[model samples]
Target: MYERVEEMIQGYIWKDLGVKVIEAVDGEVTLHMPVKTRQTQFHGNVHGGVLATLADMSMAAAVNTLVEEKEFTVTAEIKVNYLRPAAGDFLEAKGKVIKRGRTLSHCQAEVFDDSGKQVCFVVATFYMFKKE
Candidate 1:
């Protein structure tokens, strides 16, 4: 299932941002993005928006694992904290579902640099909906 989701992501905007799922299991996912000048700020640090996107994508993927085949999830709310400047060859975001309810899931994610230093943390809520 994770592999299929990873392939599906390639057709989305995440592919344009160079985001890829490196690991995934029930209720958990890890995504990687190679740092590039195009994704950085004037200071050469990775942009906050990029980090947030990584977090959001990872969390969504984690939530995906808990949803039924006919259901999908959307971000209800997300909060990100930039703990440190992110400057590295690559970035990784690890996400896990903390709680799952009938219609909502609570998730958390952490972004780390290539050196394994934590750069950002995120908490997000996702709402699940069935396909019409």
Candidate 2:
């Protein structure tokens, strides 16, 4: 199941995001992103906005795995808490669904640096739309 999800994420339309779905189990998903200079902010660290984007993407992908169809899920709301600066070889984001409904999902994601330190935490709500 996880391998299939990983394949789906790697083939995502937005290839530049560099999102690599690593594992999924029990509604949890782990994804890796290669950090580049373009992903940094003025402080030479990965931007907070980028981290939030990664969290949202991971949450959406994680929840999508549980859904029956390939519905379009959009981030309705996201609250991110920064724990530390993200300046490392790579960034990892892990997501899990806290609650899943027919059309909405409550999810959470945690971002970490290559050194295995927490960098950010995000809580998000997703709206699943029918495929047109």
Candidate 3:
């Protein structure tokens, strides 16, 4: 499952984020990002969009863990709360699938700084697709 999700995250989409996989297990996954190649806005804060992408990717990985081999997922809707400004050496995102259905899954992810201070909270829904 991790391999499947990891493959989906590859290519040009998040190619520059330098995201590293920490752990992947059923219904949960953890990801890491370094500040060296971090994308920041003009104000020098971590770009909100990048954070949202991380949240979405983590949630997708979590959902993939519980799905059939041919199933894939894409974010259908997402709500992100920027709890605090992100600043540090690195960031971590931990995602979990709270509920699942045939067509959609409910998931959540929290992005934390190096000190483990949560800088963002996200709730998302993922729509499932199957290979024909």
* Cα lDDT, all candidates: 0.89, 0.83, 0.85
* Candidate 3 per-residue lDDT over residues 22-49, each given as its tens digit: 8899999998988653478777878888
lDDT of model 1 at position 54: 89
lDDT of 1: 0.89
Candidate 2: residue 101 Cα off by (Å): 1.2
Tens-place lDDT digits, model 1, residues 42-128: 988999998998899899888887777677889999999999999989999999999998898999999999999999999999998
- Ordered by TM-score, highest first, the candidates read 1, 3, 2
Each candidate's number of clashing pairs is 0, 0, 0
> Number of the top candidate by TM-score?
1
**How good is model 2 by TM-score?**
0.86
lDDT of 2 at 96: 94
Show model 3 residue runs off by greater than 4 Å. none
How close is every model to the real structure, measured as TM-score?
Answer: 0.93, 0.86, 0.91
lDDT computed for candidate 2: 0.83
Residue 104 miss distance in model 3 (angstroms): 0.8
Task: Report how far residue 54 has shifted in candidate 1, in Å.
Answer: 0.4
